[model samples]
Target: MTATRAPQGQEETRAGLWARLGDRLIVGGATVGDHGRDGEIVGLHHGDGTPPYDVRWSDTGRVTLVFPGPDARVQHFAPHAGPSAVRQS
Candidate 1:
């Protein structure tokens, strides 16, 4: 069988995004609570090279808040899986 090659640079992009998000969340005064806890990652998108994802959190089916930042900021938060929503905040 022939060996399959993975996509080039995709991993790097993802890593970069993750780092950016982590840094921004730290700087923006956001904290990551329990994964299956009270809140959920409700949104994600590419921000202009600063924070990539405009993450939203919800508790009890109501949107509690939104976190928008530089593209780098959102990248780190993109790994979460849940309902999708975007709000400018």
Candidate 2:
């Protein structure tokens, strides 16, 4: 994984990322009152805690820039390869 710095003028445009880098994002059922997609955060476009993530989607194996919505949830991948916490928004 590479360290990412915030983009020019992007810090003022939005808040922050829904999940941290290397975190797993589950959509659809995890989406605020919705259900549907799942992915792993492979890159960050801003600060470590910032938004507009580069997600490598699980189903498609494609990387996409994502601004996670209310239905998003994060599963912190542990050193042991297990989920440490499952936090929902």
Candidate 3:
């Protein structure tokens, strides 16, 4: 078996991934012939990254509200200048 990293960002524990405003969501399987979609969280309806996020798609360049499923995973980005506590396990 091979390992795969989340596209465009790093994959950390789900604890630190509350679907932050600027974080990205990577969905689908990590293998060949996999279809996945990703986008940035622009708006948070619940104020937290719980669900129903407004995402701007990289492929379509459009913003849409999303309720991510179980197949979805989050990829968090680092701040401009700060120590990141998002460690990979």
User: Which candidate leads the pack in TM-score?
Assistant: 3
Top-scoring candidate (lDDT):
3
On TM-score, the stronger of 1 and 2 is 2
Q: What is the lDDT of candidate 2?
A: 0.67
TM-score for each of the candidates: 0.24, 0.56, 0.62
Hey, what RMSD does candidate 3 come out at? 11.1
lDDT of each: 0.35, 0.67, 0.71
> Which pairs of residues have clashing backbones in candidate 2?
17-50, 17-51, 28-34, 28-35, 28-36, 29-35, 30-71, 31-71, 32-70, 32-71
lDDT of 2 at 27: 69
Which regions in candidate 1 have their CA more than 4 angstroms from the true location? Answer: 1-13, 16-38, 47-58, 68-89
Summarize candidate 3's per-residue lDDT along 9-32 as a digit string, tens digits: 454455533766777877775677
C-alpha root-mean-square deviation, candidate 1: 10.6
Which residue pairs come into collision in candidate 3?
A: none
- Candidate 2 local lDDT, 1-89, one digit each (tens): 99787775343223434455667888666446665888878887776446677888888999998887876766655433433354457
On residues 1-89, what C-alpha lDDT tens digit does candidate 1 reach at each position?
99765575343333343433322232233455523323333333544333333333333455433444432133233333222333347
Q: Which ten residues in a row have the lowest lDDT in candidate 1?
A: 20-29
Task: Estimate the TM-score for candidate 1.
Answer: 0.24
